[model samples]
Target: MQRTFKSKIGILTHILLLITIILLFYSMWIKSIVFLVIMLIINVLFVPSFIHTEYIFNNNMLYIKSGYLPVIKIKLDTISEIISHPKKNSLFTTNPTKRYALSSDQIILYCKDNRRIAISPYDKEGFIRETIKCNPDIKISE
Candidate 1:
């Protein structure tokens, strides 16, 4: 069974996208070649990514994909603990993982390898419930 979870772009990302679009059109109006090129790059890199983020939970594997690239993949069985809401900056602090989300109620995943990953899904409860259903041994932290 495959359960797909969608991510809502955070405020910061939304603002950046809006700014990039505004500049993209402004560059066209001004006919600035250099500015147009830079805006195009920003639009290509950030627009497609933040606009389309889908987390796919397939069988025992969880796939974090954004647009064309796969971000993170984790085996459901390897999840040691799951935190629905963690303290700000306290998550992934000193950990090797990267910031997966902005200022939102993110779900933190603590793996058996002592690494934690943060993620924000539109349906937090449903995501957690589906994950737990896939791996009954996985523990959830409040």
Candidate 2:
């Protein structure tokens, strides 16, 4: 089965952006209009860049691919461990706010080569189920 995941844009983020745009327009600032227009263009043009991320599992290997500038592919053999757990409040506060709904369950991939990829999937349970199906040995924690 081919599974696809897409990060959704948050309602609050859009509202903030709209407010900024309105404020900029009301200020009669050319620079602000230019910046807002540029941002709008970027947002419209970048949908395909993030729309469909693919994960394919076959023959004891998991293939992961992300969209956009530099496409990446990682094999299952390189993954040392997969973990699911809640993120610390301090960590969440320190990170930059995202445009999507905040995730409570964070997925951490510890690679055999000493690399780590952290992802906070929107559907935590589904992500865990799918991931465990690919590699049953993966440890998942609430």
Candidate 3:
């Protein structure tokens, strides 16, 4: 079975992003409307990716995507451990395929191949529970 969950996007984050975008666009218009229009279109297109995200945990694969970003497939077999707190974990950004999140609570996944990725799921506990089911060898730290 595949468990699907939404990303940890808070309302306050969205509101702040919207306000910043509006202010930037308004200010840019003073110089040139063309610049503002082009940048506005680009920025507006990315709003969905920041606001909408879904993660799917299947038998051995975890599929995740934020907005229009490419879907990343993570094999449970490659995961060595998971850390609950982000600060304690020195997250590595070397993974070719990784997720960038905007939530306060994040889980750091350490792969057996020495790669690390940070993930933010709305249901952090449930996500860990399901991940353990897939990879029994995976260890979790508080």
Q: lDDT tens string, model 1, 1-142?
A: 7889888567877787788999999999999999999999888887777767777898789988775555788999998888887876766473534445533667888899987877788888999998888888888877
**TM-scores across all candidates?**
0.87, 0.56, 0.80
Candidate 1 lands at a TM-score of 0.87
For each candidate, the alpha-carbon lDDT, in order, equals 0.80, 0.53, 0.77
Compared with the true structure, what per-residue lDDT tens digits does model 2 show for residues 1-142?
6554443334654565567556556545655676767666655554443444444455656455444434444566567666566467533543332112223335566667766555555565676676677677665554
Of candidate 3, the 10-residue stretch with the lowest lDDT total is 88-97
Candidate 3 per-residue lDDT, tens place, 1-142, comes to: 9898777876766886787587667868687777677767767776777777778988789887777777878899998999887664355442535655556567888888777777778899898889988899998886
Q: Candidate 1: what lDDT?
A: 0.80
TM-score of 2: 0.56
Whose TM-score is higher: candidate 1's or candidate 3's?
A: 1
Error of 1 at 97 (Å): 6.1
- lDDT leader: 1
Q: Count the backbone clashes (under 3 Å) in each candidate.
A: 0, 1, 1
User: Model 1 RMSD to the real structure?
Assistant: 2.1
The clash number for model 2 is: 1
lDDT score at residue 24, model 1, on the 0-100 scale: 100
Error of 3 at 129 (Å): 0.5
Comparing 1 and 2 by lDDT, which wins? 1
For candidate 2, the C-alpha RMSD (Å) to the true structure equals 5.1
